[model samples]
Target: MVLETITRRRMIGISAAAAGMALLPLYGRAALEAVTWQGEAMGAQASLVIHHPDRAKAQGLVAATVAEVRRLERIFSLYREDSDLTRLNRQGFLVAPPKELVDILQQSRKVWALTGGAFDPTVQPLWEAYSRHFSTPGASETGPSAKIVGERLGRVGLDRLVCSPERIELPVRGAALTLNGIAQGYVTDRVVELLKAGGIERSMVDMGESRAIGSAPGGRPWRVGISDPLHAETVLKVLEVEDRAVATSSPYGFRFDSEGKFSHIIDPRSGATPQRHASVTVAAGQATIADAFSTAFNLMDTATVATVIGNSEGLEAYLLSHEGKWRHIPARTPVLVSKAL
Candidate 1:
């Protein structure tokens, strides 16, 4: 799927008032207007907010950052006709692939193994099947038949993918890869590095995923609201984060049917939609980790999620059930649960 088609699937929003309050104390100034740049990145609405005493310098930084984002998009965007990912998918193999592409493919393999195939990039074939099935006129409410799903499933496996510094290949003829699940987080982290290098001490970077650099200007944590997927107007909970990243995933973000049955998130193992929760939110030191786990956690149950979180350090999560209940990992991460007023 093209990144442009994903804008409607985003479910996280920054708390503007809270972010403003926390940023006011920067540079010991009584008040400071944040220099912000708002635009789209990897198909999702994105923004970069910076608190600095020099307006000119901040503006220059924002300009440079925007260029960085576009550059990375060319490497990761699936819909970009000339993107590295598209070439690999069409040719079934890429010789001397970009280092960044190799890096992410390898990272995807690690997450695939960690989640036990719950987060597979090779599921692009299945995604295509469902998209084609639902887009046709008078399509069946039952979705694609088992025979088609099984055929697609046969082509889904990270083991079938070959990646190295010298080459990357999709050995199976019909096999393809989509980095939509993790590319956003990967790009977010790369942008964070650029901002840090530009001398940004306190900022919030939302490039598909949200990551905070340092606490808000006054040392108070940045507040981010986790939206209720089923009820867009509701805030399931607000998070106080400092030097961390947060990502949320829900099948409701993009449903194939008008009745809310089939969703974009498919379980690689069963070719079934997620039926456990309304949404899953994860926080970690890196946006990449939070984003991938949030997507994978939706495919798991409470016990399985707990086991995964327990083994990963500096990781926490909040799960909102279909019944409107909230649960968090480790039981020590303070959360303010509330609805939009």
Candidate 2:
């Protein structure tokens, strides 16, 4: 299974994944200006590209979008010392938590149930152990010992928290939360909402993942290139997206090992899923689900991938094996397609 590069381990030290985009100009039309913005948020590069008829209005909208993204960082970023997530980790409880935090936690619980615990936010402890173990000046090439991992694994599971509208509590001492796996996509969704609220439709939000708000200038689907996990500089497939989100997760994106064999995506159950895929890409209407499921799908086998995709209403996956072979759960995913050579 392909795993997300934004495992909780990423919050400790690993850099989050950065995505790429492509937009073509439409000939024989009015000036379909595409404005762009670039900056860093949640410890990685963020970009916004939009096509609009009114340049001034769209620029203002983009500015508002950047501010919105920064606001979300305060809610979800683990790097910030005062983020709600950081405060919860430090104090083990947060009373009167922000609504956004509560919303995300509720969604995480649903994903946890859907993926059979594979998409767990409580994997923070295990991620800490592995990330810290390998952060030493000259650490061992292996993962944390079975004993160390097992102790931390005891702390794994979202059920450790008592979540409610009044407050959320982590009863277990030292228990923490990590939304890295889904936060970026959540932020992208919010940005899309913000843009749409301002009358901007033809837009692309790339905050670690790509979300297409609407069709391109000429009513064509937005084209997104899926990078080769082992060699990110290359694009293995191009997906056409319209009012959908595209997310990719891989074992080789961020590795503690020099050979790029180990990614930080630890299976909260088994402690690890063998590196079996280059990456798994998911397309869905909600960026959060697309992000969370892509991470969890990396830990699943082919049969489970098929079952999960089939049962879900409008979700699809594109799997690229470690050996460079391509596979799809339904033999054909409706929202994503490979670009013909």
Candidate 3:
């Protein structure tokens, strides 16, 4: 089955997947306009919503956004089989990749190191192993299979991945990479840079949940509704953010029960679902860091998450535990609250 999850927190009214059309009202007069266009990317349905007042400016922003998406698709998409990432997977190493891909890989390695290996692209092999084993009868219910999978996951280490400025090589044959944790955020950062360069100041572009930028019109921060942890249709809180990126990592979005046991949000470190936190939302100055840290924090224990957020300079976080309480770190003191609150 195609696993689906909402990994970010941004409010663009939901539209039917067919034809990629959203039903939200488009602002026409306020020197700000919003439009949603859907296309296939990263092996899934991708949407782009650009909001700006100048029609010409908005069009340019959309063009730049599309170009950024296409560029990332070429570098990170595993579905293409011919993508740079896919080629590396098939060949065990790639020589002389595009500069953009090289840059992202280098950045990913840095994040991997910073997170103490909690966030890793090399966990693709572990995901495949768990998915295959979980699909078999009795395997999901048995602890033995899970133990076996976890043991095998020990081999999926970031240290096994070697990257130079010109090339990347995986030491193990089965090691694969998935940019799902950071690619969208990187794309979002690029789109924001393009919009700024094009002189369009206020806009929001969402690539799934990992990237969103800009604010609404009239000098107001873009208002986003966070989905209820218990119910996807309900809003638990509203956040007003501007010129920043927000990402939500939650197991509630995509989960499945096998023989009365629940599993979702696979921990790359353990090849199993993490049991500590129910959901985490991170807002950072950059989308790539925000996206990567959300997953990294999710895999971390409560104390580590607290330590990371407490010491982080520009990162603000909202976390919900499995016990149904909300906690925040590095309190902004007088926090901004939405009307719904």
Candidate 4:
């Protein structure tokens, strides 16, 4: 599953309006000023905005953060044939793998176990099957058959993966791993940490996943508009984020069918896209947790989603079910934006 970008990255580094749900860099100029940089990372466009009084200082920090992002992508990106992940998939194992690679694989294991395999990274074979099938001439909008999905499922178990600081291996040769579901959030976290370590307090990093290190310009809370799936241009709610991470997963973000029916987030357990929720937005102290859970929530029932979101600390979810019901975990009612006029 390629981590299709949730929204298009604008050429301009900043946005003045918060009218749309594309997570605009809507930090107005007030008591504070911001410096931003837009670049490509992890097969998608990435942007960074930092509030700083000194322009030169912020430029230096932005340069370092982008460099750090490129460094991490060498370890995680699957598009690069020379990347560690690609080498592992080609050779079936990687010896003396980088600790960062091992760390994320371990983290993915925890999420896989926590969500009862709803967040498996081992679903790449199934993705390949669907991509291959759907690209055929005169293909059906419907997905592949049960038999084809079943064959791919044999290589879809996270338990079949062996991950350690020194080595990572896939037990099945046909099994490949895609970090699309969670890597963006991890990259966001790392970039934010790099910025924070440099004594930069106010910032927002959107590396597919979004995280804010401090309040927006003028100390106002960062407002994230959650897009209504039913009405693509509508805002469902506004989540005020301060020093927190936010991620949204929508099946419609990437479609395999002509009519946009099948989603890219295929359930490893079912070998089909589950439509329990139209979209899931998770907010947490850590982007990694928010990233993984948002993907998992798309495959979960409402009750199961509530139970998990309620028990998890530092986590909040705004979910819209396929039936057009809004659900918020932990009973914390956020500000729901009125429909577009």
Considering every candidate listed, which one attains the maximal TM-score? 1
The prediction achieving the highest lDDT against the true structure is: 1
lDDT minimum window of 10 residues, candidate 4: 12-21
The CA lDDT at 292 in model 1 is 87
Question: Candidate 3, residues 80-139: lDDT per residue as tens digits?
Answer: 877899998888898987777777777787777777788888877766665666666766
1 versus 4: better lDDT goes to: 1
What is candidate 4's CA lDDT for residue 313? 64
Assess each prediction's global lDDT (C-alpha) against the native. Answer: 0.75, 0.71, 0.64, 0.73
lDDT, candidate 2, 1-341, per-residue tens = 11111221112111111112223322112234656665666576544554555667757776787787778888888889978889988888888988989999999998898888999988888888878877877877776788988888887878667898788888587677899889988987887777778775555566777777666545566667787775666777777777777788987767866665557787888776476676888878878988999899899887888887777767888888877888866423455432322
TM-score (C-alpha) between model 1 and the true structure: 0.86
After superposition, candidate 2 runs with Cα above 4 Å error: 1-36, 49-56, 137-139, 331-341
Candidate 2: 10-residue stretch with minimal lDDT: 9-18
Q: What is the lDDT, from 0 to 100, of the residue 98 in candidate 2?
A: 89
TM-score of each: 0.86, 0.85, 0.81, 0.84
Please give the ranking of all candidate structures by TM-score, highest first, separated by commas: 1, 2, 4, 3
Model 1 CA deviation exceeding 4 Å by range: 1-36, 54-56, 331-341
- Report how far residue 35 has shifted in candidate 1, in Å: 4.4
Query: For candidate 4, what is the TM-score?
Result: 0.84
Candidate 3 Cα RMSD (Å): 6.4
Clashing pairs in 1: none
